[model samples]
Target: MAGLRPTRQRIALAELLFSGDHRHVSAEALHGEAGAGGIEVSLATVYNTLHQFRRAGLLREVTVDAARSYFDTDTSDHHHFFVEDEQRVIDIPADSIVIQGLPDAPNGMEVTHVDVVVRVKKV
Candidate 1:
């Protein structure tokens, strides 16, 4: 946790993310929660912290949409289920999913990661 210093805002954000069961939340949603909890943090700060956390490997990014991004505390390799209509994200547990070899890497290129975001709409 060297890189992950628990700033007041970060601590509050972590509490929001980890304190009450696991969840996948977007920056806007987190900002709203922080506001409700009386934590004064701007939406940009929330986004910056999320990006920093992701870079520090403390959180994972779920590409749910171009305009909005979801954050996951579970950093392990896995997939996600994104409900477009509901604007919700849920984890696809590691044990419940599997991945075969990835497609061949282009010449002189390597596959750093493979993120699978399964988008679905409620019926």
Candidate 2:
């Protein structure tokens, strides 16, 4: 469980997020879900809680565009398949792709991780 104080709204939101199979969801999508589920939480609260979860290592943030971001329930190493038309994301196993020929880190910086989002469209 996340280490933050468990307020009633946080508890309800967390249940919706963590009580099922791993998924990718944006704040707007989650806000809609919360409303549909009759959880009277505000959109701002959802966004703030999502950022808190991401900082607490309970979720992974995937950025598809400057205007959009999605949070993943699965926190392990992996890539993604972004279906542009549907505005959805699917997980891609980490072993399926390989990265190479990267330049060395600059100064004291180090490369710890790489996130790849392969955008796809239906034929």
Candidate 3:
């Protein structure tokens, strides 16, 4: 529905993605799921599909660090909490935080969105 071609692979991936409640998933994890679910798809294909989905606004990419990122199904305006120990992501209550800043956008550029990822480790 995000203006992407409904290819067989995309359809399968979309089913896996949107079947349950909104969640976060990494490419590797999704590739593994597809593999286990008897879907003959390659890792590269999964990555490409994810990027395509993101470009089509079907997913939101949340980069937790330089090496790890996850695709979030919920696209609403909200931040996330990255569980460091579990390597998972969850939404932070939208009303629980407030942000104030003192910076202006660069010439000809406008601030589009702000992403806040709070990392919490096991106590």
Candidate 4:
């Protein structure tokens, strides 16, 4: 499991996040889910926990725009499909696409990983 101390709140949120199939969640949306599930928690708490989880390598943060972000439980190497009409994120396996463009990293720097978000909308 993740290395953080097993606090009650963290445990509850982790259950909500990892118990089900891997999926993406925004803080506000997750806070709503917690409330509906009868878990007493706050939005700020959710945000903080999410940041902690990201730092701990338990979740991957995906930013769609300045105003919205999502935490994905599936931490494997993969890209994404941002479904605009539904405002949701879906996983895209990394091998399915080939990236051709290239720019060398600056001296003393190296690229760790790449994140690709393909925006899609229904016509």
Candidate 5:
């Protein structure tokens, strides 16, 4: 949100992403929703905007699956529950996790941060 101006389309997309409730959304899904809502944004624009939001720290990408990327608006230091069956990502509270030492990098690079995503199937 720092360098990005809130354009009409961006604001509308942001409203759809953030204003309602906390949830994960893919660019294609968002584009479909926007189209249903009568917004004239293109799919490529949605994907670009989503990536821009990720770069700006307004959204976090959930990378459980490489083929599709899910966007999250909750930028806090928390984990996620990725339901493989439903293709949903839900926040796991930060306080609920405890961390030990992380595995060392092969290149001796210091670990900047760790994101834990627990994938589960709904029974």
Candidate 6:
């Protein structure tokens, strides 16, 4: 699902993101995957394409830390289980959690959405 014209690089990135089941991936990981798949694309291009896709409502970005973010192929409302050891994210069903008593937003601004990332560590 692309809002702009299908450029070659965009098409390639889209294939990597959407060709399989819904999942999350970082730009660095996706760059590696593209290389392994014989698709030559720069890391910068991957980041740009991911942001573009997010802006176009084709993907959702989950920020795990200030230095790391994962682009989720599932754009629907859902929480996540971030496994620290594996460095992977798995979907937590949207209906499994409920939010309550949210304070009002500032004037002229609205809450677009809320993301819940529950960190986990294997014992």
Give the lowest summed-lDDT range of ten residues in model 4: 1-10
Per-residue C-alpha lDDT of model 2 across residues 38-96, encoded as one tens digit per residue? 99999999999999999999999999999999999999999999999999999999999
What lDDT does the true structure give each of the candidates? 0.84, 0.94, 0.92, 0.93, 0.87, 0.93
Model 1 scores what on Cα lDDT?
0.84
Return the candidate ranking by TM-score, descending: 6, 3, 2, 4, 5, 1
Candidate 2 Cα errors over 4 Å, as ranges? none
Give the clashing pairs for model 1. none
Off by over 4 Å in 4: none
For residues 1-123, what per-residue lDDT tens digits would candidate 3 score against the true structure?
688889989998999999999999999999999999999899999999999999998899999999999999998888999999999999986677787884899999999778899999988
TM-score of each: 0.84, 0.94, 0.95, 0.94, 0.85, 0.95
Model 1 agreement with the true structure over 1-123: per-residue lDDT tens digits: 437777999888877877866678889999999999999999999999889888987788888768778898788878899888888888876667677977999999999877888898988
Clash-forming residue pairs, model 4? none
Quote the lDDT for 5 in model 5. 89
Question: TM-score of the candidate numbered 3?
Answer: 0.95
Alpha-carbon shift of residue 85 in model 1 (angstroms): 1.5
What is the C-alpha lDDT profile of model 4 across 1-123, one tens digit per residue? 478988888999999999989999999999999999999999999999999999999999999888999999999999999999999999999998788776999999998889899999999
Query: Which residue segments of model 6 deviate by more than 4 Å?
Result: none
Ranking of predictions according to lDDT: 2, 4, 6, 3, 5, 1
Off by over 4 Å in 5: 103-110
Q: After superposition, how far is residue 39 of candidate 5 from its true place, in Å?
A: 0.5
